[model samples]
Target: MKIFGLTGWSGSGKTTLAVKLLPALIGRGLRVSTIKHAHKGFDIDHPGKDSHNHRMAGATEVLVSSPKRWALMHELRDEPEPTLEELVRKLQPVDLLLIEGFKRDRHPKLEVWRPSVGKPLIAAEDPTVVAIASDGPVPDARVPVFHIDDAEAMAAFVVEFCGLRA
Candidate 1:
């Protein structure tokens, strides 16, 4: 699958942009999947859920399936966190994969920036950042800039950057 990324500091609206961009890409008849990197530990299954119980009962992997959907939860146990490439390989093929975070990985990315966040631009140090989406002008940006609210434009950029056809 063609891969692209959105990276930014905390509270810079990367998730918001990604959420908007999904439908824009889907509206163009493209199949898209997303992978988000969370800095803190997260859980999808709650304590009372059967899947959660199975996992807690020493199941290495627990897969829950229904008519509508299925999800596989794998326990890392002693295994280290998988790399981006390893995680990507586990996904079913799609026209595009939009990754959020993983800024250190060498993939084409758009930096979601907001001056109000009081953080410096990541594009300055990351060559893989091909563009910036910001609420205000990025005067010193070496790459192209887009308004943060322009999901259509950003989606189009992603399609073009990944060479994905509608």
Candidate 2:
């Protein structure tokens, strides 16, 4: 599967744009999958649940299955965080893979920029940034710039850049 990424400083609308792009891409008949990296510890398991109990009892990996879906939660208790590539291999193939975060990884990414955040622009130094979605005019941007609210345009850019077919 082809890969593209959405990245930006916190509060810069990366998730918002991803939410908009999902249906846009899917409407074109593409099967889409997403991988998101969380900077802080987050848990999908709830206390009192069997799966949760298994994890708390020091199971390194817990696989919960049902008629509808199966979820595998791997606990890296003392292991290093897996690289982006490592995580990608765990995902089932799809027409497109949209990754959020892992900004330091070498992948084509669209930077969602908001000047008001008062943070330095990541695209300024990251050559992997193929395009930018900004809240305002960015005449100095090194790559194509689209209005942050223009989900259709951004989605089109991604499909073209990744050479994706519907």
Point to the candidate with the largest lDDT: 1
lDDT of each candidate versus the true structure: 0.95, 0.92
Candidate 1 off by > 4 Å:
none
Per-residue C-alpha lDDT of model 1 across residues 130-159, encoded as one tens digit per residue: 999999989699998999999999888888
Best by TM-score: 1
* True-structure lDDT of candidate 1: 0.95
- Give the TM-score (vs. native) of candidate 1: 0.98
Worst 10 residues of 2 by lDDT: 133-142
